[model samples]
Target: MKADVRLMVTADGSHTAINQTLDKTYHSVHGAFQESQRVYIELGLLAAFEKFPTEELCVFEMGFGTGLNALLTAREANSFQRKVIYTAIDANPMAVEDAKQLNFDDLLATDYLLKLHECPWNLPVEITPWFTLTKQESKLQDWQTNERFHLIYYDAFAPTAQPELWEPEIFTQLAHLLLPGGMLTTYCSKSYVQRNMRAAGLSVEKHPGPPHKRDILRALKMG
Candidate 1:
């Protein structure tokens, strides 16, 4: 979104985008690939499968900055023989055109990174037989969806970088959009953030985080 955007190599040899304007990066600098798989795919999506026991799931992703979570979720859904409807919203997807340069293809064994970005926004585009992605360039605060999500990938910038995004009022609004038994996963386990989720009427719990981080959060909406 700006001339100051740059691609960075993370610990797991995958790439992440840094926005100099916001002083924030899309993924964890510690290890983008590891962080993405653990926080979103392995933890978030799988939890939904356990709770829902369905072959199909709808996901609402807070940030589609790098499409790393989208890619991994697609892969996981394929492996699990499930259909994933991924709705990713990003206010301004930074370095998206340049995101093709990331080393994720080699790591993921799929060259669909550019395909993920080039797909038209505001419409569902089939990225694979098992995955359909719909990108929405809308801010989370202003986002309204008629569809409820079974899983939520809350991959926004850190609370410190964008405090408003982590506010309790925002989570309270998001809580109404979750299907019963749905859950949300995020790499942030800050006490305040957990409090926000709890305040929104979600059951919050702490889980082990990826490398270099102590804890992550998984909040569930019971049926």
Candidate 2:
């Protein structure tokens, strides 16, 4: 899927990609940085760390879109002084040129986002001493990996835009990728979405969402 995207300033003065092909915005219009920090970092990453404090944190992200989640995760790894191995896959990644147009460097006062975009795909690149990134050019359905992750950032497009991605089969595949007690977080909390996760053998929870959103989801794989 080749995505035709245009950079736009979100409500928080951060940059987001508007997918013209799918008629969807990569991040919330209310605030791109706010949503990523709240849903992925605060709720997802922090919770995962508390759940598996002594273990090496391995993360698998379904959609790498603008690399915002990875950027945030890298920063968290540095602050927590924990090593994080992050693997992210996207069928249609934003062009590096377009990624350069983002304002995350300005917001973060760091050049991490630039490194994330410039890193080679299909190989692990150490973004920091505490963080390593592996970007893959693949789709969720097509990806095959023996690695299991402690946390999953399901930052795919909305179900309305990509219904196939939210299917029960997809959740089942994701469930199998998680280690015991592993967690999957998404910015969606629809009834069917929760049901699908449950049917895939995950215990689901509804958490408070970011601004302009009501609720999000965090599903766990219980032994």
Candidate 3:
């Protein structure tokens, strides 16, 4: 909410959160956006998507920061000829004009950046014949959708910054929204987060983290 949260270009010309509290960036100092693409998009979502049938993939993202994950997913779906119904929730929606000013176009290429803005808000907008995006400018806790998702990207802020969002009750609710055998991937590997996932009826696993991160959490809903 603070205007002080300006995007900083990292050493590798990637954008990242410049935390006012710590006076540091939230992601890697080397390549902020590049690290996110590798960790969340490639190792997390894309890897999970590859395991399942690609005809129709339902994806839900918790924090749609900069729409990086969403844009990457769209590009992948288009390339693979996979149909995707992407639902993303963000409490504080960024201004489209401001987003346009960011270096996302430099990172993801110009054409994809344009398509990202073209994807409608609060309604399903077709990106391709097979890929559609439905964005919600609301808190994840308040989101109520009957559509069961096959994959979830839990990219909330650190628990320390926003503890309420990481509570067990939230995870329980998310579990109910996932289809059986669906997977949830997160950058957090905290024990409390793992416990919450288990409480929500998911089988949890730990995987090697991307670059600087030590570990990451992946939970699967088993019927």
lDDT leader = 2
Ranking of models by TM-score: 2, 1, 3
Model 1, 1-223: lDDT tens per residue? Answer: 3225789999888998887778888888899999998899878988787877754899999988888999898888888888999999988775555876878888889868788988988999999999999998888989887999898999988977889999999999889989888889999999999999999999998899999989998999977
Error of 1 at 189 (Å): 0.8
To one decimal, what is the Cα RMSD in angstroms of model 3 from the true structure? 2.6
Weakest lDDT window of 10 consecutive positions for candidate 1: 1-10
Ranking by lDDT: 2, 1, 3
Which ranges of candidate 3 are over 4 A from the true structure?
Answer: 1-4, 18-30
lDDT for model 2 comes to: 0.93
Q: Write candidate 2's Cα lDDT for 23-68 as tens digits.
A: 9999998999999998899888999989999988999999999999
| Model 1 residue 203 lDDT score | 98
Clashing pairs in 3: none
**How many steric overlaps does candidate 1 have?**
0
RMSD of each: 1.3, 0.9, 2.6
TM-score winner, 1 or 3: 1
Best by TM-score: 2
**Per-residue accuracy of model 3 over 36-55 as CA lDDT, tens digit each:** 67666776667667777644
